[model samples]
Target: MTRSAPQFLCDPVLETVQVEHGFGTRGAVAPGGTLRPNQVHGNAVARFEGGSGVDPLEADALLSRIPTQSVAVVTADCVPVLVASADGGCVAAVHAGWRGLACGVIPAAIAALSEWGFTDLRAAIGPHARACCYEVDTPVLEALEGPFGPALAEAVRPTRPGHAGLDLQRLALEALSRGGIRSDHRGSAAAMCTVCHPELFDSFRRQGDQAGRMIHWVRPIRDA
Candidate 1:
């Protein structure tokens, strides 16, 4: 029954939300806009500053400085992270599935933005499978342990005392903390699990091939 807040990007200068959706697609919704989504089994991020047409920029994270430019990413069972500057008004969106988490995508994005001079950055982690239902195999557990660490292991404790479930959101929060993004300033993490809440989200793990995607978008809009 839970729902994610409709993520809207704003400059406070322009005052308009550029993109309407940020799900399962790869291309800008507007001219000066940019989007990238990938199926690769790792973490990566891209940045945009000016007008970028509808072209697929393959990456899991995106950042932008331009007012109307939109940087987008996609997800299914993964956590979709949306970040913004606490004082600078800049923003970035990321796709953080288990593999992406293992590859350090969220932290990498935070690090990249830090290089750009954003100190007090806020982040919001969107809907995805939780430790309550995201069970994994041995290889997945081992792989996740490398980047997610012992806490990640603990988060994925056995659901029924023998079977394990991975918490992608917890991994994301830990990644953000490791990346130096303060949690208090960060926004909300969608409580709805894509697998458990079939009515609201698209779950690759639970629904398999039948899951329909949801959008997580943010863009500065022009004032009327």
Candidate 2:
């Protein structure tokens, strides 16, 4: 990693690797940046050239060419993924919940940027529900296990006896690795599961039907 400037938002959950020394507030235009939010629950990725329109995308991942600008992904329990390839000068934000993880959204984002000559991209998995509290039905576990083998099965440990809890960020990390991103290029925020740490995070699982989502995004930028 080259150790560039910071382009993280004020919300604290969001993290970035390439664009540096900047921040943004929700609904406010990013200073010298552009923003996009993920629709999530789906495996779609949208690309933006210049800082153009508002609410321009309905996808799980967003990519931008504008340096210092950013695209945002909001989530409560889902994995908020920030990605960048400074060599290619491309950045993306992804919201990969369990469904999105099973649907292969991470690889889709990698493939989307492959057209732009982007390689050796770095990825960051933000705070979300870990295996500690992400209880799930058997179908979801079976779905994950069918592709990833026993490691995923082992990671999704049984909380009680019948139900299993999942490490979603691990799932996303596995997917990223399977997608060809090396471990050296991957970054993860330690601990702080949203469901377990309510004071520090906003979790749908913890907050129930009315939880307010936290947003994460990043973009390429030219120095001002």
| Global lDDT of model 2 | 0.69
Best by lDDT: 2
- Show the lowest summed lDDT stretch of 10 residues, model 1: 10-19
Question: Where is model 2 poorest over a 10-residue stretch in terms of lDDT?
Answer: 20-29
Candidate 1 overall Cα lDDT vs. reference? 0.63
For residue 37, give model 1's deviation from the true position in Å: 3.4
Q: Output the lDDT of residue 66, model 1.
A: 57
List candidate 1 stretches off by more than 4 Å. Answer: 1-34, 53-56, 159-163, 220-224
Compute the lDDT of residue 186 as modeled in candidate 2: 75
Q: Against the correct fold, how does model 2 do in TM-score?
A: 0.81
lDDT for each residue of candidate 1 in 135-162, tens digit (9 for 90 to 100): 8877777878887677876677665544
The CA lDDT at 221 in model 1 is 34
Best by TM-score: 2
